[model samples]
Target: MKVFLAIAAKVRGTGVERAMAVARRSIGAAFPVPAEEVTHEEWREPGAALLAWTNEPGPAITYAAGVSGYLADPRDLPAAAAGDLGLGGCYSLFTCRSAATGPTGADPVYHAETPELHVYGSRALLVHLVATGGRVEHDPLALQSMVRQGYFLSDETPFAGVRALPPGHRITAGRAEPYGLAEPTDLASALVASVRGIEGTARLTLTGGRDSRLIAATLHAAGIPFTAVTYGTQDNPDVILARKVARRLRVDHQVIAPKPVTPDDTATRVAEVLRTCEGMTSAYENVAPHTPFRARPSLGGHGGEILRGGFLLGCQDHRRKLDALFLGNLDLLTAEAAEHARGLAESWQPTPETLDHLYLRYRVGRWHAAARAGIQRSGLRIQPFLDHRVVTAALAVDPAERATQGLVHGLIAELAPALARVPFEARRWPWSKPAQKTPDWRSEPGDALKSAILGSRELAAIVRLDRVEPLLYGPRLPKPALVWHLATVATLLRPMRMAVAA
Candidate 1:
């Protein structure tokens, strides 16, 4: 939460006043700072720092760490610090801005190279901040992991000096450990409070998914007026089920189709999403969903999986098989790099709590949150599931409630039985077929995909470009997910090309 602004740092050609405002609004703290002076809590440290946006007031850990709800009991920190840290209710992004002079003592300096952009930093800051010319040198391993799959084995970012603190884990005096995972309070009341907090022209995105449905039921019970919206093709399962949900709740609903897309249009939109996502995930055609909503701070369901065990629906729970299985679609990688990435996953500390923590940090935080960012840009208000109160409750609840999505079912059936009586639709798409039990990507080959892969310097250099011949010319690749990554990688590289041009 502490911000160290370099001397003469200007975010988007503005003084500290505007830059500081951007940072405050990002985390939902809006205290006014009248001058371009150092923040009070920041004075506890040497550099320009802002007090972290947290409810609990405690000593900020001397090591690189941030806490959200309850700072785990201090007695627990020393013992758990050595493992993969997942402090259940904390979040922090960190970097050591020194040149590569590894390990002055016990702690090695973390490399950070993201250019100064907004007061609130993000991956997309590069496209805007780097144009006039700050170039960030990325680690090769980090770049490959982001492009080939979705995340790197460690917390490394594309820019060398920057690394994020993995959730549920925090550092103290250069040591890292597992943040305590258990929360004493359950999530039911917290979730309801989250829904009730929305006021003044509020909106919700209702997919056929349980998270959205639960939120809808809660809103109905609370007597809150919200207009639920669904966007996709007319027959898409989300659209249809959301319709049933709206009708049953007796609330207003709206549907927004993707404006017609051309290859060029797809390229433009994909690049926009990549800018916000920091090239961590790909953009699909879902970009038009938010245009119809004029509401501020739209609600979304992000951490629903934490309660449902959604990430590993059927995959083996252990590390080896999960490593092989999660990376199954990325055949485009050369044998060598692919093996290294798999090796990393294999060694990943395996536990349900740890797995859930990482999934929330990377998959939902980076990939899903980034996708939502791509869709709404600045439109989305908040995702209650990711909130600190929500996280604390989820981590604290009994494990049995999470299995088979029992938590979701229990809450809805208890809160709004009529809505639950209407069975959940089995299909998640417009016209899904068994197709050997995989997502059906058997649509005719897309020219946009081929163009995206072939037209960029960054994609050509990193991927075994020669290995992608099948995708570009010879045959239809059956995986929609793989195609998406390729398109996203292509979109991320466009800015690199533009940097060259200007």
Candidate 2:
């Protein structure tokens, strides 16, 4: 059984209503379910109001989208009724309040405004809650569990009372303050060492993009053998470029074709993967589903962002155009949502002048907060861009040189011209052309054999939440937004979960 819960509130203006309406319509379109056809019941009483909806009674998916006040109170009788009725399978709880509101200790306990969004999930329930007007008090046990599982996000500050897992679960925060100078040579060695430390057959997910390619080239130069993996539908640019790199290196390369997955299968797979990893199941449900091969000692191209000076570089490059675009869409988001994002940015100590900081601190933070709950679930080992010494060195470079100086791939190209010839493609590639082009790699003779040797049944069981409708939206949610949210959540959760689980 999977259930989702959310707490929603009526905004002062039409922003909340409009956003909700858009979200609901989007979810409906994606899921293709009629609103009126949805089975529903509503309850109204003094100091309490309730609405419940379900489809296909037994072991069915249910989601609750509630207002912050509603979530704070959650009328005991109604909660009991839900439990008695077995109302939700996988639950998502959303805690919502108005952005205009501020937290007051003296405010109504049930209706106080909050700024945090908390989401939790289990086989039987999924909780998604957002604190709209105030900050919700952290629950120690919940926070600990989330951290151990790698579900929490926010690089600026640690959540109060939460600690990273002991021993294996802990990745040394490493050097405390940022190193002042760039040390690519040392960083590269560390990156290589990290990959070499992994026992068994190691694979690198090569992209035409510079990050993975740099990692791949480094490994190649180090004389470490690695099988490269790529994914896409037929003739995808990444597939083409990865093959070129593999051919140049004379290493095994595999391309995974995307497959349409069903909801039940996704749910079942995610639950199994989470159990195996002993972590929370998150939105990156599809990642596990699409994995061509299983778990092994492996390396991924993750630290590219930090090495390249973060997404701010790109945002800066197109600031003028983006400003225009943002102005156009400003009305699309609720004022409260905007205000919530602003308040969050301020709390994070972001400089008002840095537009990029504002965007990340507010927009990205909100989305990550909502999605981090899921990432903590997959339990996969993740070596983020922040972990690599090369990245650290890159960060140490003058901000002018580090920011949009060039693609990290370009830097790798400078280091190893021969390896740079290998092609990779990502939507965000700095270059206009695809990374590398080659003969169809998916049909290569040894691809299937390699998959058989490296794939894991456990990894395969991780579900793609985007494929599961009920987990994403309540009976009332819009389909498109549900799909978007599902995909976003899956990506965040799967990698983190895999990292922690390993």
Candidate 3:
């Protein structure tokens, strides 16, 4: 994984050097790699500086994270073409608006850009703030939104004054502008090109689903050499179907079954996930399945659901009705959070394309973007469906045609008719089945997570510990997912609160 911090201070006496030093210390604490592997660059006139560190070879380009690309110089930001970096991967990049101005560019996924400082690394931003002696206050609305909806609404983060850039938009001179994507003339060719852009080995997380199957077909059609890896027991439908797909394509197939983790390791995994994701999303899986993809770039089928119109499919075509459908579940939200969610819902224009665009912007851009950021900390993931060309093609498809995954099926058949012939798994809402025996929430908290949450004053301030005493002694726990979500929030706030208290 690569970690970096970029700062652009235009003022002459703003202590730019001191700021960079603090940033380096912060980033070092998180990465802890050899000093020689870190690359440092500076500019005098505009008072710009960048510190990029990677475990791999060559001078690191900290300008962008999560995507493989080249950066000629820090000053090229203002004139950077969108395609300068390859398509269909999660990333955060810093581009300058002009020779004399701060850096600006399109928001890839998890990035924060202020007037003078632009941070490309996810949790590195939080670490920098603590090291620089800046205030690290929590955003109540954002915290509530995370607990209620498993993600922050709009552009807000759990931390005050920090905003994750919405995908497909660019920030220049601290202002946002639309960087439009044109629909691809040839969708299959675009998919092929996107996969070919990856630098090293790539593996597809093959599953018994329309999205992954479509990607598998494209890889085979293009003659791309890649492995299809599945996680779960052999009896699982995903594994069973994935094996058939790989056999049809005649590609190497591997399956990694889930293994139990010791209690100590479970705690450690939870903490790592919280820090990596920077508390922008939930931390449901305490013991992530081990896999070979952690060290290699993995190809995933993210953002493909947009082509199928999978978000709020049956809801009425009205803004308020859509709001009620998506944002009305306020059982866990605070009063302020409910209001903010409603405001965001009402802000959308009720055009014919509202459903698809809304999902693309919020669900894929914000939620999935954060999730991918966390996953990339361990390994790189290339999402071909998220490429600008593919997104444009998806948006241009007729909604009625995609209502039942018609677009996905047609694309797969066009790419490889034999692979499309295999049946895939489909489930209704609330995907997970009930556990054989429900475990008590009080006993389920891992040691590290329990200690971190119980000792934090920051979490106590946001959540009322007295009201829900019977319900695991704190924060609303309607289900196991909510429990993990609250634990993630606590773990993320722990380090920031510790730094402040010290």
Candidate 4:
């Protein structure tokens, strides 16, 4: 397992060398693998290119977290061309306008960053790559899109010029193209086999949901030993159902409740998350259950929704699902900003499966903050849903079945009846919302956030600080949403240098 950092641009210079240092610091790869063992590729002709091992990669094929793909290939590290790249799995640093040159010739500028190319001019790029490798600074439109439609929603990143590589496309020397994939196999069996391929005992995250239960059934059928865990408030049905499933399977189970969050603790934690993850997307997973399984391979239900249409109720049109999705979430923006967010949504292609794939790419597979990144913090986080086997099988399913996740439910009901009997966590959504708490919005966290937003001379110029105060205060929405948005605004607006210096 290896995770490497790659930087390529039109002209070779000190910027590339400096990027290597940033990569090491960014990945926290303290020990170099000795110069001789390190892999290096430099292409001088087409605007120089450079690829170096950043901290050793964890696995040769790190599964794409929220999508059906892999980062590095089994055939080679730093895949040679677009065809070799995985579908919708890449983040490159380069400067190429329309029609990138053959292998890419010297462009006007040199850019560098990871997860995705950060092209918000020099300061924004430096803050994300060097200041805090996790989150990137956004321009006005980017900030508005995030505040309203959710972060990482449009191909538009917070930065200008830098674009996300759409699912199924690859970037090679700044050249990008889509590659067709071979068909996948039996997803249920594939889930088990994928875990077996990893040399170790596996731990599963059992939830009051079809995805986790489905995986548990498949793993049980294959005779793989695993420990199941559920964490959150005790009253959460997911905790109860997960326990019931674990008991039926005769597997060890643990239920952990969330720890109390102090204002200072939250600020620091949120700061770290906002900086590491692509957006303000984050949740505090109880560390207690994870402690016992820290060293073992853990499996999650990431990307399972690819088989289920997302919270897309009332969205009838193919091309305008993005608009529906934006509307589905709460409104925390000015009328102008909300409209701007809506405009960004309209840019979505009118494909039937557009939202499904976009959700996978932008929300899940984009970065580490969630289970994808949690694996980095915890043990090896493996999501069987992202396995090619599951992806292939899922695509073959009829769209209608996928919409209701009929396939997943059927699989569980047949293979794991006990799990099927339990009430689903989502079933209560219509009648029940999580108890929303009103926090002291004018207190420490709020003041800190206010200062952060106001301090960012760049972001404040466009984003009206007046509007930010109202949307972030009490009664606007749920506490969790309010907390996260504050973290997002603060993290994105505050420059890394200022954050650190303060």
Best by TM-score: 3
Ranking by lDDT: 3, 1, 4, 2
Give per-residue lDDT, candidate 1, residue 428. Answer: 53
Candidate 1 wrong stretches, greater than 4 Å: 1-46, 49-120, 123-133, 150-153, 169-182, 232-244, 255-266, 284-295, 316-321, 325-331, 349-354, 397-401, 426-462, 490-502
What does the lDDT come to for candidate 1? 0.49
lDDT of 2 by residue, 1-502 (tens): 1112222323233223322332232222111123443443333322222333322222122222221111111233245223221111111222232111001100011111122222111111111112211111222222121221233222211222222111001111111121122234454554554444444556777777777777776666556677898877546667777788888778998888865543333334434434322232232333332122133445566435545544455554444533432332223223443343234334332222344333333223222323322332222233424332333344445544545646566656654577765544545345555645443322222322223212322222232212332423333333332232223223223422322100
Per-residue CA lDDT of candidate 4, range 203-228, in tens? Answer: 78788877788878877776778888
Give the TM-score ranking, best first.
Answer: 3, 4, 1, 2
Clashing pairs counted in every model: 19, 87, 2, 12
TM-score of every model versus the real structure: 0.66, 0.43, 0.78, 0.69
Residues 111-141, candidate 3: write the lDDT tens digits: 4455445443334344346334454556666
Candidate 1 differs from the real structure by a C-alpha RMSD in angstroms, to one decimal, of 9.8
What's model 4's lDDT at 391?
59
TM-score of candidate 3 to 2 decimals:
0.78
lDDT by residue (tens digit), candidate 1, 72-149: 224434322223223222223322111111000001112122244222222333322222233334444555566656
Best of the two (1, 4) by TM-score? 4
Per-residue lDDT for 88 in model 1?
Answer: 26
What RMSD, rounded to one decimal, does every model reach?
A: 9.8, 19.4, 5.7, 7.9
